[model samples]
Target: MFNIVKKMPKALWIVVLAHGVTDLSAGALLVALPFLKAKFALSYAEVSAIALMQNFTSSVSQPLFGYFSDRSPRPWLMPVGCLLSGVAMVASLLAPHYYLTLLFTAITGLGMAAFHPEAAKTANRLSGKAKGKGVSLFAVGGNGGFAIGSLLLATLLYSNVSTGVLFYILPYALLGIPLIQMTRNLPRPEVKQVGSLKTLRASINWPLLSLLGMVLSRSTVAAGISTFVPLYYVSYLHGSEMYASSLLTVYLATSALGTLFGGAMSDRFGSKRVMLYSILPISILLYLFPIVGDVGAFVVLSCASILLSATFTSSLVLAQKMMPNNVGMASGLTIGLSVGLGAMGVLALGKVADIWGMPVIFTILACLPVVGFVLTLFVEEPEEETVSLVVQVSK
Candidate 1:
């Protein structure tokens, strides 16, 4: 462990912590959703509306940030975004009414959108020969943040409708100011970073579009799991809020662990193969969600979460490699819009949950990974020479 840490660039760990800091907002949102639902007597659609607005902003704003990242360094966005997201999350929950919650949540998401592109671009460049491992480490930081936030909020509730619980995360936001400051003086990579519109032109090809679809698919599956699982815990399983949130922590934590290894595996085998292996086999696990009891279901779902998340690092790395001149743009698209598109699925699934049930929601979600698997077949892996070229440019 010490050797691994020693071998990696300091920038990777800094971003890992930064990634963790911003994502606490997401984890807190997931845990808070059911409570907010019960307090507001929220319909499934309304619950999803909050999620939609949050994810919508989070995803939609990435390209703008990515554009800036590619065009020039904006280290300041990291702290600003993290601070905005954390404060907004606090204000969103403490607001006097529901519409205010939606507004604040959207702002909070924009903070996330602001943070990811620059952070991801930095991680990729600093990753040296271990792009997979570097990206995976960065990915896991967000995952760990979500997991820890879930656990903290679930356990720290002072009351059933506790607004004060949201304050616990504020210190993290405060620390983020200095955390992101660490990146300011770091050396910029020597790559030929492109402008925003040119990024779109560069990515305007069949393979890139198809790969983007895979990015969307991967993100949606992740979104569905995070958005709905807590609702299922509270609604279908007759579980306590703590129980429901704990399950989400388990799911996210398992996914974080999987993220730890995903990059190394991608470097060894290939991104497409890792994508194929991760996304395809999880359907059976999800298919069994209803047949088992709560414990059994958690066990199955945890494993499924690991498999579903394993592709994240590999896919992001692949997109960056493919669009070497506009890595920030690719990172933004992959991290932001793709995630936004996927999280939007929760709105549809929420509508479905209103009509059918949670079990049906999972049943429907089971097929999405297969779709992702098929899309991977159309995306050609980057050749060795291509990767080396990008590395040389960055160096």
Candidate 2:
């Protein structure tokens, strides 16, 4: 494990930092919402509109950028994206009218969409044999950035220093210098037709749809737990909202740790095995969550978060390997589509919560993993030789 960590390239580390910057900007929007609402004299529906618009743009545009990245290999998008994301998000706050703020928010999404697929592709290409580890490191950076973004910006605003919003720009400027130098000499996209759609279609492959099913299932359960569990904990279990928030923080932190380890484990034991092992237990623990005592529920939720997140990098790396010819598209679908669809799933789950109850919502979540497990069973292990062949062709 130590050796694997040591083996990652400097370029991959830069990409990881860039990934952090991207998510930091995206997450800052959440913290800015209440302030924006107050400043604009907005209603709850409008505030929700800001979030929904940002998410919709980011989620939907990623694959479009990703598909283009595979053909064009625009490495400059890395630094450019980081800059655009930070500048636009901060600008949204400073915008005078509500419409301008919303437009900046959408552009911020486009910047994030521009960042992820390219960054993920770079991480995987530079990782050498430690591709899983490399992608996981990239993922962990985003997780950390997201967690810190909310806290950092919220602290600044609460401190009554509105100028602190400008502070978010510093990291991008500092990081962008190195990123520009690093991306300058990246390999141009190869024009070979061997890794093209027709040739690759003839090769043996795992079903991409199966992997999609697995990701959707995982993301749905994850989104549900993150969104609804706090309400459940406070309302049904009688914990303080603050305490529930603290526990939710613990869950996010632990899940990031889970992402780091999951990749290393996948590298050792095959991704298919790791995916199967990581997902099945989550179903059991989630089923037990509502039935447990307070401490037990906390423990169960934490463990479930770990196990659920453990599949993130493994699935991502697997998707890249499965479609080496279209690595950017694979990354886009795995990262962007899952998030977009999962948020949609959360909306559906919200309806469930409204119609049934929180407990019923948990019951539905417990069933999702079982569906994911069945999908995993159908995902034939992606062929390493095919992965190598396509990668070589792409280069």
Candidate 3:
């Protein structure tokens, strides 16, 4: 019997925990936003714009952070990123005006952008022989954090906004201390560091570029679905907020499980094969999502969520391997650019949903993975020489 917990590294575990807490804080903020919207008399469009600002900050900053972390001596970038993001989350709670709220949200996004590329790069480096598993474990933290944050914040909101915001501070403070301690004890790897822009440009290998395209397309679908699922359930299915929220929880939780499965499977098989197989099922489920009614939509969405998340893990593992020298840059493009840009699709899909209907918007989203799957055929896996070149440039 395989003892998964025992085999994982302490550092990986710590990173995962930090990732979760950071995500949880972000998620809590997201869930709490509706309350703020009601209190401030903001329109749906206004609320969405605030959310978009957050996504924009995260998307723009990730690559920049990746570029710097690759060359910087500070091994504490990931932990510091987490701490700053947590502080930003708390700051948002203090915002007295809409503009200030948006500013703080953007700051939180910056924090998130800073943590991921550096932390993911570190996780990939530590995984070495089992990079897939390592990335998967790291991803699970984010997924679980999103789930926990939503649930916890929603529960706390029943009392008051202040209470909900205050609840998060304890977790952040507790988690930050250990992360600081762990980072101090860890030794930095010896590698030739690349110049910021030059390294980032050079790290963009053919395989990595193809994978980034895949990430973007898949992200379009993932982001659209996540942002709209709650509204879709409420409007189309006549579901209660609690039930709709539960469905979202199911989606995130299963996605976490999928990350674990996909990561481990990639280690045993190959990243390409795992990615190829997962996309078909994801596409099929996504296509089926709009047509299905009531509880059936939830079931199909759950299946689609798992496949989508699993493919994400596979893509991350493959991209990291392709640019082993610049794992931060690789991680930035895969998670930061791909996922972040994808989240931005919410704006477009929202417009489409406004005009055509939610089903049509989803049907459009369903096609993204098929594009990604086809692109997968053209993407060649990275070779040893390419990885070595990347390593040299990264140094």
Candidate 4:
């Protein structure tokens, strides 16, 4: 393990750490936002709307940023975006009213949106044979951040909200210093000469687009569960706040394990096969979640978490292979658009929960991975490319 870490590039390590810290800050915000809503006397609908704004803004802008990043020379876009996002988060501390808070949160989301395309593009470029491992490692940073943030926020909420808010700034400030050093030493990326979207659309392989759609659908389920599982446990099962939060931690931690496994499997077997096999088990587990009582629910949630997240790296690797010329855009679509748009499913499922109950929502989410499984059939594995001058130089 030490030898393997030694072999990885310094830039990749920096990106991973930076990704983790940024995500940690974001996670802190996610966990604390609910409390903030309660303190402000906001409705559940209003709280959901804030989340919708964050997702909507992030999803729409990501593809555009990704498209431009592919054509641009500025590899520093990642760090700059991170910096702006951190600043935006700091500014959000001053939001005295709910509307102002939403605006600041949206700005923070835009900053996050900006970083992803450039950072993911960099990861794809650096990851040669073990693309899955690389992506998985990056993802683990985000997940770890999320887990830690959730745990810390839950703990702090017992005391004072101001303490949690103040602690959020620490990670971002610490990360900014190292980002400067990493930015200076990085190699310059060559700009691609891809034509307009029409030509690009003509050039796009349909199988790849189908794969994107599968990811989009899968994201709906994943995001819905991630955003609301705690609420379900709390409201439907009459679980304590700590228990609900603990289940969420269990879900996230298991998902991290799944991510690691997915990346490893994709590197060994093909990404498509790994994804295809993982989906059915995940669907089955999710479908079974609400029907089970106490211990059974926890067991099922853990399993679902692992299987669902395991698909993440494989799905991303598949996209990167499909669009070798525009990896930034591809990564953005898979990681950003699919994941971001998937958050909408939370709102949709929330409505379903309101009408029918938690069981129905899980049943609806279960169908998504099956759809992804069917879509996986159409994706063709990328053929080994003849090593062109650009490919050679990129390495």
lDDT of 3 by residue, 107-165 (tens): 88898898898888878766767888889999999988877886777776676555566
Best candidate (score: TM-score): 2
- Order of the predicted models by TM-score, top scorer first: 2, 3, 4, 1
Go through the candidates in order and give each one's C-alpha lDDT.
0.79, 0.84, 0.79, 0.74
What pairs collide in candidate 4? none
Candidate 1 structure quality by residue, lDDT tens digits, 1-395: 22224588666788888899888888777677887798788998899789778878888889888887777778787778878888888777777799998999999999989889988888888888778888888998888787677666666564565555666666675676567668676786555555556545755688788888988877777888877888887888777988777777688668876776678888888888988888888777777876777789789878887777778888898888787767888899988888778877777888999998788888887888888888888998878687567545553
C-alpha RMSD in Å of predicted model 2 compared with the true structure: 2.3
Count of steric clashes across candidates, in order: 1, 0, 5, 0
On lDDT, the candidate that comes out on top is 2
Residue pairs in clash, model 3: 191-395, 192-394, 192-395, 193-395, 325-391
Provide the TM-score for each candidate, comma-separated: 0.85, 0.94, 0.92, 0.89
Per-residue CA lDDT of candidate 4, range 73-126, in tens?
456777777777666665664567888878877887788788887787777666
- Show where candidate 4 strays beyond 4 Å: 1-6, 151-167, 189-199, 386-395
Tell me the spans in candidate 3 whose CA falls farther than 4 Å from its real position: 1-3, 160-164, 190-196, 237-243, 292-295, 384-386, 389-395
Question: How far in Å is the alpha carbon of 95 misplaced in model 3?
Answer: 2.1
lDDT tens readout by residue for model 2, 1-395: 46557867788889998898889966687789989999999999899899988888888888777778876577888888889999998899899999999999999989999999889988988887778788889999999899888887787677777587788788899998899999996664443322345433543355677888899999998888888889997887687898788778888889887887888887888788889999999989999988887688779988988888788888998888787777788888889988688878998888888888779998889999999999999887666786666667555
Candidate 2: Cα lDDT at 115 = 91
Query: Candidate 1 at 257: error in angstroms?
Result: 1.5
Candidate 2's C-alpha runs over 4 A off are 187-206, 236-238, 390-395
Between prediction 1 and prediction 2, which has the larger lDDT?
2
